[model samples]
Target chain A: MKKRYLAGAAIAAAAALALAGCAGTAGGGSSSSTKTLTLAEAQKATSADDFGGMDGLVAAANAEGHLNVITLPPSWANYGQIIQGFEKKYPKIKINSANPDGSSADEVAAAKAQKGQSTAPDVFDIGTAVMNQNLDLFAPYKVQSWNDIPADYKDADGLWYYDYTGLMSVGYDTKKFPNGVKKIDDLLGSDFKNSVAIKGDPTQANEAASAVYMAALQSGGSADDIQPGIDFFQKLKQSGNFLSTLPTQATVASGETPVVIQWSFNNVAWGPAAGSAGNPNWKTVVLPGAGLGSYYNQTINADAPNPAAARLWEEYIYTPAVQNLYLAAGAYPAQLAAMEKAKTVDAATLSKVGAAPKDFVQLTADQATKAASLLSAKWAAAVG
Target chain B: MTALASNHGAGATPRRRGARPPRRPGTGWIGLIPFSVYAILFLGIPAVLAIASGFFTSAGAFTISNFSAFGDPVILKDLVGSLGLSAASAILGAVIGALVCYAMLGMNPDGWLRTIVDSASSVLAQFGGVMLAFAFIATVGNQGLIIVIAKQLFGDSALSSPIYTVPGLTLVYLYFEIPLMVLTFMPALEALKPAWGEAVATLGGSRWTYWRQVGFPILAPAFFGCMILLFANAFSSFATAAALISQGGIWPLDIQRALTSETVVGHENEAGVIALGMIVVMVVLMSAYGVLQRRAARWGS
Candidate 1:
């Protein structure tokens, strides 16, 4: 028995050493390929709600001198964009940033583990579901533009608020949506049945979850009742038109999946980029309809070790000029006035990517949860 | 074997009473302390936490709800699916490994066969996760090397398909498992002497007679042991499945199911339940083999 145990121990040690070595050598984001936000992409805020309380927060945070913000992306896409512009504006603070994988529950657990310590993130760009789950960890503060956000979106206690959303912009082979259908009903036609695609793992995504929430709302059930959402996938499955997974960019332009339920910016980035050779055939199709979008939000960590840097980053990312950088990069910005002023979210881009006016299916926390569960199960069944 | 126990006094007392050879002093045992320490830290602590947590949280009451969640069809299906795949991989691995071992044994020891087995086993052992995925894709994808070659040979209809299906997943797994199997079972084969086969053959015995009397009796325990190891390795793995699924996260779907569960509270239960069963099964098989090995030694003496 001792000999056997010893043998198992030896095997385990050798394996652990190999795994540790492999892990160190691969996949970690220490390269120039790592994404960072810059001041050049920082758009200025125009809506009165955005700049409202930022100055005080920035001043408070700056007195501390150093800031460490650990948040997830879309915000990571340009946390530095509008942020460093503020650093240029202030010149008193130093910042460190870490963008953990958004889909990892472990990363969220790690942040919870470090909540009160110096290592805790000063800001959290959390998902809708988790933002509410860890609300207690944050130190709540209402920003200047707090009122511009709907009461339902921001925490009344001011722990966190909506920063931006990754709505499902309908993408189609412009070759197929020739007249360019711009509504949810537009997707039901024969031309787009098997052609539409969805990201495979919707359970981990805020946007995908929100889409199901939208479907429940649009089809007459409250978001709290997600039977409609389940039925939605079931119908798609029975129709034999369900293409459940779409690669981020490669599949979109290839016309394999003509319509993709994807982020606005991914479509914006690749919509009509110089194709691999001459020009790719497909184009983007943005549809405006009820229950067709998901919002990826940014929220400040209330108990930030570096509240100044967190606040500074908040102000930096909310500006119009910087917001346009995101627009240019392929994401829709939260600050509408800034985007309008910059005139970068072009009509062509909007037609290809933005949600149509009057189609928002706003949901509360309880409703979002119920919708997430029902839709995820139906999605599993659908994929199966 | 049953008749032998009645005659235990023949060799049993002498063996039991005789002064056993002192274990080779410092025969690699001291080199194992770090390994023991690691097992306690990683395998021991996590297992303890999991079992303890299943009973009660640090703060309060006990709950059997984690086990109850297995009532869900999805959970049960994942458990069964994982077992099925692991068993399949293990059997597949053992067969391929045995065949390769037999083939290599017949060849000259210093020949090309040895070189091929050496390099191939090492390379296949290292092939995992994304690199494994890429290798399969390069073989069977729409734009893969084989598909292109086949298209020129056959036609465009060949590209209109999925080479990454469930069958394809099993094939990819076999690619690695067969090599690892070779790595695991090769030592026993190397230890085997040609004299055993020739001696039995000299008595005018047929091949099957020799194998039954000499080959399998000697190597059956080793091959079976290695098969169980293969099953355990593949069963516990998450990454290869994660990479292979069609934009999906993991195969057996259990790993992804575990990851996406809102509460981690019940995850260990479902995964641990299947894993714990595999461990129990493996322990039983190995124990039985150990007993058989003792019986075989007694018979040989």
Candidate 2:
């Protein structure tokens, strides 16, 4: 009796394992069928193309019922509010956001790696250089408010458009440097010894590259030439003023990195938080005469799992209400100028973001590509 | 011959001389099926893919330029840097760990102190990466606890030095390397027989002479083997260095850049080539280790 029971148990276990394997294969097979919406139909659609205009797009998106977004940290540009607001507005569509803290490179990598799968990202928030390099991966779909986006910020083919801009600024602990660094040239002073830090490798990080570009502009170099910036950093390293470290809030508060060169959005968001942590004198200053602005672009995946939902997301982000949400988070929305002109922007939010600098220069895609390659080839050796 | 003799003595028995016994069902070679499947799925396939990709371009065309990039000065510098760091840490860990093992040998092996030390060494040998980096930062970073204490006591910036530089990284690498050394080198230390010491003494050899001749020669192979392991461990380490160093210029860091950099074209194959280079280095060291371990095994048998 005992032997018979053991034999039966073994057979049952084997059957269960076989069933589990079959279930996994079946589950994987079903995901491909879930992509009922087509990329071609979505790309061609405008307000004129559809009967209900934006409402029809929303209806079509609701039918699709899901969106896969990637590399959106909640804290980044107030993505938390944007995502929450989006979901609350469109209760029918569920957003499956992957890798909240992942980098721009990670977003590109995921789109490439998971090309045909349901888990593939439908939207990307990436740097301009990265977006330009992987142009083939993005689909051409102009949002309803496409004309409002600046001419310099959008692709000619409607593949990608700028979402928000971050101006390069210096964030410093005021307790350490009572005089404060108001300009890029001020960083070279004797008071900032072994204190200054950039965000990360300029070759990889967009903010760090922009910081270098801002430094170049201040030190008599054009956007076409980043050599002066590299030279400046080398000089700083030679003078024992530049720390080859990535700065964080903790590092700034601890005096390990008393001064940091990063995006205005990041500095503005984190400066007050760092001050509240212990030091109450943290401040961020936009360098005078060096107001360089770089924007992160948004693109829909060419092979997005939910085509209608992805288009809907792009449409939602370009609206005046959402643009104000970005402004409130310390980022200059790509549609800020247009919204202000239309008197659609929230006055309170605009006042809080402060006045836009008149001479802020945006890099062309070609210039950005060239500068990125230059930095990749030269930054390491120059800094070291 | 014995079976044949037994058969002969039995006379007229049906059992034939030198005939094999019946094998058990579901045993013998069949037992290795699961392990073979595992090896093929995990190790064999990935290694084959890594090598195959190294010889191919991103467009699937064959190219040798991937391997050719190994000769580039920047790549060569990174490779040398990795080698130097690994060698320095491994040699330092091995020497210090051997000393520690010798000290442990003098203690009662079954004691609570021995038990605690052994357990701690095992746990610490596996400790590294992000947590270890954060731990060091909290304890010895620019505004770390020790630094703050030093500043208060001495009125000088004694320990305010940056802990993210190359030398600092070497110190971090040693945190696990020394304990790993203790774990790997202890058995070899225990393998040293007290009888050999007595024999050397009986032969009128001094303790110093015994150690220089018999002791050093016997332990040399195992020491070298452990050092090679430590070297491979340090060479292939990624997370600790990645977490600490922001601007990566080391071998693993360069490999990371090649694999992940958006601006650099044709780096996918280069990443495979760099990986292949690391495998070659590790294989060479492990081959040396295999030979030494085999030699050491002779003494055990």
Candidate 3:
């Protein structure tokens, strides 16, 4: 009975503690309450990825010097370089960007944690797909060059814009395919069995996945319809050209893999000649016909902590001066006017970039949802 | 009660024979000082903020929209996935840990072998997040060592496709979590002293009977506590999942929506709803588990 009493008394005490917990502190300090307007976004506001020239937005916030850019952990390595550039170019604007390990989830949490002026990420970079989910959180700030962005790339609401684009092009074994394996439909054979590699299942990324979708579109079937992609992979798999890894371009160049399907820049990054020196024969080609093109975009938060700098950032990135950096970095430009005067890509390179990707099909939310569903089903059916 | 009495006599009663020591008034609650501060800073305050933020708007007005986000399919799916994964990991940890402890208690090898096995628990217990995911990938992804070996040895076409599969994730969770369970259970299992089981057996008790009568009574509470720790540990797995979730497209939902989502749009509030749902489910399961454990403890005693 005494033991029972002790146990019961303990239970009561715990309950009281629970009730106390539920009641919580009637008042906590500003630490619980400050609204740090988070900008969990990339730099569309910077006018360009290169931060070309937007002195108006960067010049000391017009003497107020109030822009704290948190390029915190996981912000890509390039972002660090860009942030340094942003700071140097606009030192008067108090642009503070912390490092963050760039992941979609981290980007989202940074936004969520900063619910208001105190804790909000004023703006941040995110992928084209997730930009819309964050649409409500973002306030609209259209740039002067918004009209110049391809009609296909910019959202109707001006929530996000494609900063630059890449495509799922092939980097072939130039030694093996001396005849120049040129077209999209060329790799459909038994000869290249168990020979190709993908970074992930095509469906994992828009660039690679969009290639499959483009294949379907080229063969017959729009974005909402993706049977051709499924069939294409099915044929590739049957031929044994389906590899998950290491029959990659690196593998191919090393004679492990003969053909690799990868991004345009990736092919450039893997250039045997580009690496240090003395490495041989790393070359790439955009497919002859309209290739599978996808864009990695820059989005500015609507409720950016440094709204003026954000707008200035938008202006700076789209200019011809800064866009050359992207060209050097290996991506196509959004500005046609800039492209017209671009001394960046020479005649030989211009022909390879494939005539400025004639058909630009951006995915609408409903369209994307349906496309994801359809493509996903096709991917599973073919791969499984 | 009799054993405790003997223990009291064996130990210093501290009250009789002038053995009593005066309380240092300041140190009476000294042990709880760190706990008090830690609780407020990490747990108490964050929880209050999480709850309060759920009800209040940007302008500080109360609204049902926060709650409404809970009904969303994507949020619901994430909540279900989180709970399912956590529960599965916990169960796997428990079962695997229990078996490991059983092996340790009465197995083939002894001495250094046992020590090696014992140390393994601690080694694996320390791994989490990206390191853990990468380790699993190295072991199991399409480009993993095992897959490479399987292909080389068994003609390259094996089960080399778990890079982003659900089973692949569970396999990773099991790797670290089972080791953690063994670490947690080692002491509790060790406390089930061999002498007690022998004594119970001498009283004509069967193996099951001995376990039911004496062995279980001591370990029950500790087992439940360990399981609870495992549950909570696996509950908020954001980094590891994010690193490995290739095209599965499921991501960990957290805090609030100062961030934007790409896959599912126009649903920032859904994160709060998911968080709240997780809290509810966790609370319910923990409460049920607690009550069941209490009943088990009562019966064991």
Q: Which stretches of candidate 1 lie over 4 Å from their true place?
A: A1-100, A104-107, A116-119, A172-197, A210-246, A250-259, A270-282, A325-334, A337-356, A376-378, B1-20, B23-30, B50-62, B148-167, B246-256, B259-301
The 10-residue segment of model 1 chain A with minimum total lDDT is A39-48
Which candidate achieves the best lDDT against the true structure?
2
CAPRI category for model 1: incorrect
Clashes of 3: 66
Model 3 — TM-score against the truth? 0.65
- Computed on C-alphas against the true complex, the DockQ of each candidate is 0.15, 0.25, 0.10
Q: What is the TM-score of candidate 1?
A: 0.74
TM-score against truth, every candidate: 0.74, 0.86, 0.65
- Lowest lDDT sum, 10 consecutive residues, model 1 chain B, at B1-10
Question: TM-score of chain A for each candidate?
Answer: 0.64, 0.82, 0.66
Q: Residue-wise lDDT of candidate 2 within B203-251, one digit each (tens)? A: 9999999999998888887788788778878888877777777777678
lDDT of each: 0.54, 0.75, 0.56
**True lDDT of residue A172, candidate 3:** 70
lDDT tens readout by residue for model 2, A1-384? 122334534643554454344433331211221332244566454332342466656666776566788868665677878999999999977787676755577678778877876667889988766676678888888887889998977887788888988788888888878888866767788767678899877776677788888888988987998889988998887777888767775676677778888877777666663347533566878877858997788888888866777888988999998898888767899998899899998898778778667678777767877887788667877766
Tens-place lDDT digits, model 3, residues A281-371: 6567766554565676666655554555666665666665455444443556676444665454344545544456666555555767777
